[model samples]
Target: MAAVGGLADDRALLGRTSTAERVSDILRTRIAEGFFPPGTRLSEDSIGGALGVSRNTLREAFRLLTHERLLEHQLNRGVFVRVLTVEDVEDIYRARRLVECAVVRGLGAPPFALDGIAGAVADGLRAAAEKKWKGVSTANIHFHRELVALAGSARMDELMRTVFAELRLAFHVVDDPRGLHQPYLERNQRILDTLRKGDAAHAERLLADYLQDSLAGLLEVYRRRVGADG
Candidate 1:
């Protein structure tokens, strides 16, 4: 009986850890992968029951994502996935230009991690060619994310994460992952090549233009979607 009780307790502990981590991961992945549409309400009870967790555990997960800006809390209404407005998208791109351009400029020589960036770009291109928009989008983000990480600033990395999440939510609403990101794969490659050539200034300029053009294209799609839906 004692051994059985001990095993039960161990199982319970494992279950709790698994629930919390799974809740967090599911929320993040769905948000990133565009499964959870923006402006959609997320009910703690419903989500918890679906994931086989307690409401308390689900709330903890909500709190974490709320901190990440992927979820927003209303005074009494509850949490909803963040919706990026046109202004929000513009702000995100503006910030990206400022931070990412600085990151490239600061790296005097290409870091060894340029190989990883190249790999991510290649993967994104392949995904685009194969018409796997989601895969391409993920790889596209990975490419910029790795570039930002090259600067080696924890704070910058965290900021980039928030920006990236917002962008993903925007993609979810726009709903043409291919139309939005596929055209940019080769641009990403060019930027990588410039960095590899140790042309930090040129890379910075290219990234800024790329970000602007991409943001403009995405905003057009978003506007059309909003119009059609309305």
Candidate 2:
């Protein structure tokens, strides 16, 4: 997990936004980055002191993330990252399949700037080679982010960011990271390859199938975890 303190590195954000907004942005980024995993308690004093903000400001920040469904407030226990259910995982993939596949299908041609998407795929390949499963997971997230960027809409990108952040909560619940992420590395390359060939229809089909398989596997894992707890 990345350091929570890394949030303070953005000097420009510090200079511009209100204290609560600034803290919320930092915490939101950390949560999206998987620095604070599901069920990890967030201490008011600790985060407030670290960010140099008041406890009141930190609580407001927490409220913002809670509204985003990234953090949940438990009475008496304080704030912790949200833990997603199997249904939540299915809904996330449902949205991803709709948006991401539509983006690919709607692309009428190629020779588009694909540097970011390709870079993300390469990053995932390298991380898998190094056996860094967590890095692979992060790179996979980046790959999807870049995939959505092909649509070229700021509003769509923002919506996908929120979706991806919520998806990360489900990912944190997986017991086998490799089992969750390794197979998709090559599939990502295949999608890019199909796109490069200008076969948008085929690429869309591949993406839909990919999401189906991923969602099925994730649901199984989530159900197993719940069963074990029972």
Candidate 3:
């Protein structure tokens, strides 16, 4: 079992608001940030003591994450970070295509509020220049997330948040971070440029193909890793 180290520092983040949901949020970010990699058994004692929260609260937080598919509890064993299978990888990409392409296709108007998307792209570019592949990966996630934010729908935002977190679980299996993420940086910019020109149709096409290509590449990496590990 691994200790979810530094959860104690999150006490400040909890601030005056102490709740299961807040605890879950902190754990979720840590998971997505790859601090708690997949298959890591979460220590109840370590986490509870670190956060200074009750066992019930920590259990509730674990339950929420389990429902999100970021964690799983084994009977008589313990809770562990969920490791995504190949099927899960394919399904996640399918969901991404369905949601993301639709979001691009249903554009309302030209010259949209693309600052968020643009900023994410810039973030990725900076990270790439600095040889921080992981940072680039994070920025890529933020790029799509900001794209979904354009819809102004809370439900959509929340849905993609869970999806993105699940996707990160699969990402942990890949060995070449730069090879996986660098190619998409330009595609993200291209999509942004297409949107800037108000050509939603072209942007949607680009995103659709992009998702398909990404899925294929990820499936290959996932299969290779799964086989080697087995």
Listed per candidate, the RMSD to the true structure in angstroms reads 5.7, 7.9, 8.1
- Tell me, by TM-score, which candidate is best: 3
lDDT (10s digit) by residue, model 1, range 83-197: 8677777788988988888888788654436877988998998887788899998999999999999888999998998789778888888766777888889899999888877
Q: Order the candidate numbers by TM-score, best to worst.
A: 3, 2, 1
Worst lDDT run of 10 residues, candidate 3, spans 9-18
Q: Any residue pairs clashing in model 3, and if so which?
A: none
Q: What is the TM-score (0 to 1) of candidate 1?
A: 0.84
Two-way TM-score contest, 2 vs 3, winner: 3
Q: Candidate 2 on 1-230: residue-level lDDT in tens? A: 36777776876565434788889999988876678988889999888888888777788888888988898988888899988866677788989999999998888777666889899999999999999998899999999999899999999999999899898888877889899999999999999898888888998999999999998887888888754331
- Residue-pair clash count for candidate 3: 0
TM-score of every candidate: 0.84, 0.87, 0.90
Question: Which candidate, 2 or 3, would have the higher lDDT against the true structure?
Answer: 3
Question: Higher-TM-score candidate among 1 and 3?
Answer: 3
User: Sorted on lDDT, highest at the top, how do the candidates line up?
Assistant: 3, 2, 1
The C-alpha stretches of model 2 lying farther than 4 A from their native spots are: 1-17, 227-230
Q: Estimate candidate 1's alpha-carbon lDDT, on a 0 to 1 scale.
A: 0.83
lDDT of 3 by residue, 115-181 (tens): 9999999999999999999999999999999989988889999999999989999888789999999
